[model samples]
Target: MLKFVKGHMESIEGIATYPMISLLIFFVFFALLFWWVFTASKRYVREMSELPLDENNQ
Candidate 1:
């Protein structure tokens, strides 16, 4: 099964670029998420963390 799939994939033109584009998208998404986590306000983080425990919201 693997051999057949690999052979079929190898016949397609521009298939190699798909993996590179997917990798770039994955890296950029995580990089932005990491940046946001670091730059987010402490107050906002604290509020979000306590949201589930806060009865007033219910």
Candidate 2:
């Protein structure tokens, strides 16, 4: 296990810093997506509520 870890660590040493930065970019993209979906869902629900007629109002 130690040998494997050392080997993998050595191989990844050059890219070790990049993975963290990439993860940050990934999270930022996902966060933007989540925010968009959240606001869009709110708009959708609001629009549906404003319909002229519905099962309850009838």
Candidate 3:
């Protein structure tokens, strides 16, 4: 089954670019997330972290 899929995929031109494009998208998404986490306000982060333990929240 793997051999058949690999053979079929190899026949398609530009299929190699698909993996590169997907990798670029994956990198960009995580980079933006890392930036957000670093730049987020400390107060907001504390509140969010405690939200689950706070029973007052409905």
Candidate 4:
């Protein structure tokens, strides 16, 4: 199965750039997410964290 997949991938033109583009997108998304998490307000984080417990109490 791995050999078949590799053969098909090797046959495709421009397939090499696809992996780089995918990796770039993944890295950028995670970097943005990390920035957001760190920059998010403490109050907002507390409120969001308590949301489930608040619902349970009510």
Whole-model lDDT values for every prediction: 0.98, 0.83, 0.99, 0.96
- lDDT ranking from best to worst? 3, 1, 4, 2
Which stretches in model 2 have alpha-carbon errors above 4 Å?
1-14, 41-58
Write model 2 residue lDDT over 1-58, tens digit each, in one string.
Answer: 9999888888874767888999999999999999887777777877787776665656
Runs off by more than 4 Å, candidate 4: 1-4, 55-58
- Scored by lDDT, model 3 comes in at 0.99
* TM-scores of the models, in the order given: 0.89, 0.44, 0.86, 0.77
- The best candidate by TM-score is 1
Model 4 Cα shift for residue 44 (angstroms): 0.5
Encode model 4's per-residue lDDT on 1-58: one tens digit a residue: 9999999999999999999999999999999999999999999999998988795666
Candidate 1 — which pairs collide? none
What is the RMSD, in Å, between candidate 3 and the native fold over all Cα?
1.2
Compose the digit string of candidate 3's lDDT tens values, residues 1-58.
9999999999999999999999999999999999999999999999999999999999
Can you give the lDDT of residue 9 in candidate 3? 99
